[model samples]
Target: MKIVFLIAAMMATGLIDSAVAAPKSSKQRCEIVKKKIRDIESRMRAGYSASQGIRLEQRLRELKKDRYRYCR
Candidate 1:
């Protein structure tokens, strides 16, 4: 009886943990991507090198695409 109760308690705790540990939803992902894009754009405006600017631009484009895909 005690072992059964212990197992039940462990299972209940596991379920609670899983409920609390939710992954980022699509809206959350979009928000994060937008923030990163804004930061990168600000850096680009602040006189970044050509190559670094190009990389950041590419990343920004990809993030925009992701926003369209995920946010839709």
Candidate 2:
């Protein structure tokens, strides 16, 4: 009975730790991506070439799509 109780307590602790360490929610991830997009746009406006800006925009779109698909 003592061993069983000890095992149960250990399991419960493990579960609590796992929950605490879980990744951020989808909304949080989306906000981070949005911020990144804005930062990229600002950098582009600061003198990056048109081609570079286009490439960065494409990458940002891809990142947003990926985040939307996986973060949720």
Q: Name the TM-score of candidate 1.
A: 0.62
lDDT of 2 by residue, 1-72 (tens): 997885685345321122344347767666656666566666667786677667667866776785777557
List per-prediction Cα lDDT, in the order shown: 0.65, 0.60
Those runs of model 1 whose alpha carbons end farther than 4 Å from true positions after fitting are 1-23
What lDDT, from 0 to 1, does candidate 1 have?
Answer: 0.65
Weakest 10 consecutive residues of candidate 2 by summed lDDT: 13-22
Clashing pairs in 1: none
User: In lDDT terms, how accurate is model 2?
Assistant: 0.60
lDDT of 1 by residue, 1-72 (tens): 997885685345321122344347988777766766676677677886787577667877887897897777
Off by over 4 Å in 2: 1-23, 64-72
- Indicate the TM-score of model 2: 0.48
